[model samples]
Target: MKIIVDAMGGDKAPEEVVKGALNASNNPEIEIILVGDEKKIRPYLKDSDKNIEIVNAQEVITYDEQPVNAIRKKKDSSIVKGLKMLKDKKAQAMVSAGSTGALMAGGLLILGRLEGIDRPAIATLCPTAKGPILMLDIGANSEVKPKNLVQFAVMGSIYSKEILNKYNPTVGLLNIGTEEEKGNSVVKTAYSELKQISSVNFKGNIEARNIFDGDFDVVVCDGFTGNIFLKTVEGFGMYIFHQLKNEIKKSPRYLAGAALLKPAIEKIRSSMDYSEYGGAMFLGIDGVLVKCHGSSDSKAIENGINVAYNSVISSINEKLREGLKSVTEKGE
Candidate 1:
């Protein structure tokens, strides 16, 4: 499988991105195409083998520029060029740790949306007490109709089942309350619609507090709510670790106890790490695209590439198309 990496997209461009690509290229069956300024990316590939290829892209779309405008004007940019390669079938997938706005815009403009999909959603794997739960529409579409939520649920289910290896994944709608009568008009309508869809194993509404229990395999929400939920979880995880460290330092007794429980603490820290899950998948896009964090390190980028590889090999897009078709046929 061939996967393209946006070499100049992230904060640690060219260096960390190149290192991640090289690491992922250790798999002989996978070819890594690094697209960026050749001069900057070449140095990291001194000991690289045949699986790695470099494509020169002179421009880079920055977070400051307008997303659509940057994509249109920066024809030679790594984001645009790498997306174009995917559109042209030169590669199976593309991974970028760049501006999220540019990646989403370029994805729609270049690769287009799946035939039956309206408004592609970003599916992110969130670590929970039980395991990883897939959440969708996180920072993708801030405003969405009821139908959009239904689509997110469908897409999230397919991804959970195929990529995450979940069997008959149960989906939940993120809401203020678990009751069917709860939430705003969009969610209420979505609840009614989601229940009617036979293709999805739609569970009732799930509150934010209950999300960590991992009772639901997939949770669908509008980007406005999902983004806040994702950020709050990340912030809280950091806060917990920070407070623990400060508390441990305050007392010698606590310090000794923390040292004894260091292994357990390290395991908890690993579970909370965003890099462990790689990156979010831009589901409903016509082609495979994985969007990594803007500040992603070599490890995060490497895992993101593995995500792209898995998506391509699993025929995720094809399964999604079929899933959507089934929903449409059922008049959902």
Candidate 2:
């Protein structure tokens, strides 16, 4: 399958993006299409590989630019072009480390949403206390309606079951307290609806602080809250890791323990990096769309490629079409 990669997005720009895409393309089973300025990309790529191609793009949207506005104005930007290619079926999926808003807008505006799907939500695999956790709406819809939350739950459930290998995964609503009446109006409404859905394994509300403690398999919330929650966890993980290292460096006994636990610490730290989990899947789209981390290295890019390939070959979109229709028919 052909997977399109926007080579202009992220902090490292063309170099890291190019290397990541090239490394992904190394897998003979898949073809990688890099969308960016060909003149720049060509020089970085010494020669040609059958699996890789550079599509010329004139402009690139920066993080500071308004996502939807930049997407509309920069018609030749790498993200928009790659999105168009997905719509045209020139690629199975589109991967970008660009403006999150622009990518979401382009996916809906260009590729369109699936049938029976309202707003699309972003779901990323996260490392949690138990194992991998699926967090929906990391940064898709900031403001959400009750119905939107229901849809997010539906989409997130399908993802957890199909892609994450979770059977009847416990779905949790991110809130301040574990009780049903704990959160604001949004959570109060969503909790009632989610609990009513018998098909889903609703496990009640999950507080933000215990999210990494693994209270549930899939956590659902609006992008606004989910984004804040994600960032806080990342920050906390980094702070604690650095603090532990600083302490260990000052004492011999602590340093000895640190040496002994280096492997275990690396494993834990790597698990929380978010990149190790690959990209965030844009649910409710007509096709799979993954938002790779801006600082994604070769391994993360490779995981994104594998996800794209599996998404296409598995006929995931087609299955979602059927699954969603089934749920609606059942009045879920």
Each model's lDDT comes to 0.93, 0.84
Q: Write the per-residue lDDT of candidate 1 for residues 1-332, one digit (tens) a residue.
A: 99999999889897999888889989987899999999998888876367988999999899889999999999999999999999999999999999988999999999999977889999999988889999999998999999999999999999999999999999999999989999899999999999999889999999999999999999999999999998998899899999999999999999899999999999999888888889899999999999998888999999999999999999999999999999998787
Q: Pick the candidate with the highest lDDT.
A: 1
Among all windows of 10 consecutive residues in model 1, the one with the lowest summed lDDT is 41-50
TM-score of each: 0.98, 0.95
Candidate 1's TM-score reads: 0.98
Q: Looking at candidate 2, what is the lDDT of residue 216?
A: 88
Off by over 4 Å in 2: none
lDDT score at residue 205, model 2, on the 0-100 scale = 89
Clashing pairs in 1: none
Summarize candidate 2's per-residue lDDT along 281-307 as a digit string, tens digits.
898988778888877776677677677
> Could you report the Cα RMSD, in angstroms, for every candidate shown?
1.0, 1.6
Give the winner by TM-score: 1
User: At residue 30, what lDDT does model 1 achieve?
Assistant: 89
